[model samples]
Structures are given as C-alpha cells and as structure tokens.
Target: MPGIHITDIEAAINFWRERRPSADGFTLALPVQALASLYARMVFQRQDLADEQAFSAAAWAAWQTWYASTPDTPCIAICSTSQGDAVCKGCGRTESEVQYWPEMGPAEKRSTWRRITAEGTAWRFNRYAERARETQRSNAGNS
Candidate 1:
C-alpha cells in the first residue's frame, strides 16, 4: 500500500523506452509496462487506481532494482517528538510528520528525508552518521 509512486512509474517507463525499446512501439514486456502505464495515467489524470494492490505489485516489479538501493528511514531508535520537541531532535521530523509517517506516500517520505538531511540538525543526521551507514550496510547484507 505504501510503495512506488507515479514518478517511479514514469521513470521505469522512460528507462524501458530508452534501453528496451521495441520496433513495434510496444514495450518488450507488455504486462508490467502496461500496468505501470495504467498507474501513471491514473495518477496524472487525477483518477484513483482501480486496484491499488495489483498496481503496487506491478510497480514493485518494475522498480525493484531502484527500490533496493533507496535509503532506509532516518530514525535512529530515538524520538524527541514524544518528549515534547516540536521538531524532533532525534530524527528531525516534525511531530506531525512522525505521527503521520506510516500513512505517508513515497514522495512525501522522500521530501521529508531530503529536508531532514539538508537541515542536518537531527542527531540521526549529524551525530549518528556512522551508525546509519552501519545499519544500512547490515540491512543490505541481510537482504
């Protein structure tokens, strides 16, 4: 439910168009490409996806390689928002962002991630850089 975005679908379509183009103007793989295209159309045309689960699965398949390399959450097992900080000193998210994180779409999450990293005020961003890298490496190895 909280997976790929329309931008991701568009990127995949572009990649396929450039790297795996077909002579007949159809993608080399119709099913997944068509699914992603449908999702992109739904998003850009301001329509809801008819089947979110199916679309998520198809988008995951289409974007799995990129997904694997994406950064993990910025949380460092500490949350200052719960301790009454409006902007979390632990991870740099606002209280509202922390409260609504699970419901956030990929694009929203990425935007928050960018802001936190750029601000570099959170303990997780500044003091825990090595810890974050270690955790990422550990998670990647496990995967």
Candidate 2:
C-alpha cells in the first residue's frame, strides 16, 4: 500500500469484508480503487516518480496533513473487522470499501479520505507515523 499504510490497508479490507465478500474471492486483497486516485493525484501534483525522493515528499506532505489533524481517523470506534460478524458496528464500510479503495476516482478518493480523516479533524497514524518516527529517530541517531 503506497498511498496508505499496512494497518490502514488491513483495517479497510476488514471493514469491507464485513458487508460482503468480493465476487472474485472471499479474502480481500490490496490494489483497491483509491490507489489509482493516489497515482492520479501524484501525477497532478507533479510529484509522480519512481524515485524515492518523490515518494518521500508525497508521503510526507500527505502524512503531515493527516497526522496533525485533531480528530484523526473519524472512526466511531465501531470497527467492522471484529470476529463476531461482517459489517462494521460503527462505520458502514464493507468489502466494497476494501475492493474500491484503490481504484476510486479522484473525487471519490478525496471523499473517502475526508471521511477517513474526518474532514481534517481525526487522523490515524499507522504507516506515516512509523515512517516519521523512523526518520526522526534515524536522524537523531545520526546527528
């Protein structure tokens, strides 16, 4: 998951599975709809590149905005991936949410991100946090 982190990816996949299994398979996987939106955004932002620097820059900018948000994750604490059953008790996301996350269009992706971020209020730091921490720690160690 380039645009999103692994935990978020797992959470999202689990979220979607609660509603229904994908037509193709029961186990949900990556390559969701939103990744395309990320690619498109990267291209649009002129940050699209196979290089590490491009990825670092894009990831940093994205993370900074999301992580600093007061609310973060907008999750109502009703996770769908719980063992009891499919479908989140709190959020309405389901298998489709997982399947569609990577391929969603820009508008759709933005909407999803907004919801996930709770309109810049809530932020979930899974991948970005790890990355930021590692970078800072490494930098400190180096300095």
What TM-score goes with each of the models?
0.48, 0.28
In candidate 1, which residue ranges exceed 4 Å CA deviation?
1-61, 68-72, 130-143
Q: The CA-based lDDT of model 1 is what?
A: 0.67
Query: How much lDDT does each candidate structure score?
Result: 0.67, 0.43
Tens digits of per-residue lDDT for model 2, 1-143 = 13343333334334434444566874332333333334455556765232323334544444333334323222455455464435433444454553465675333443455455553322133544456688999999999
Alpha-carbon deviation at 97 in model 2, angstroms:
2.0
Worst window of 10 by summed lDDT in candidate 2: 48-57
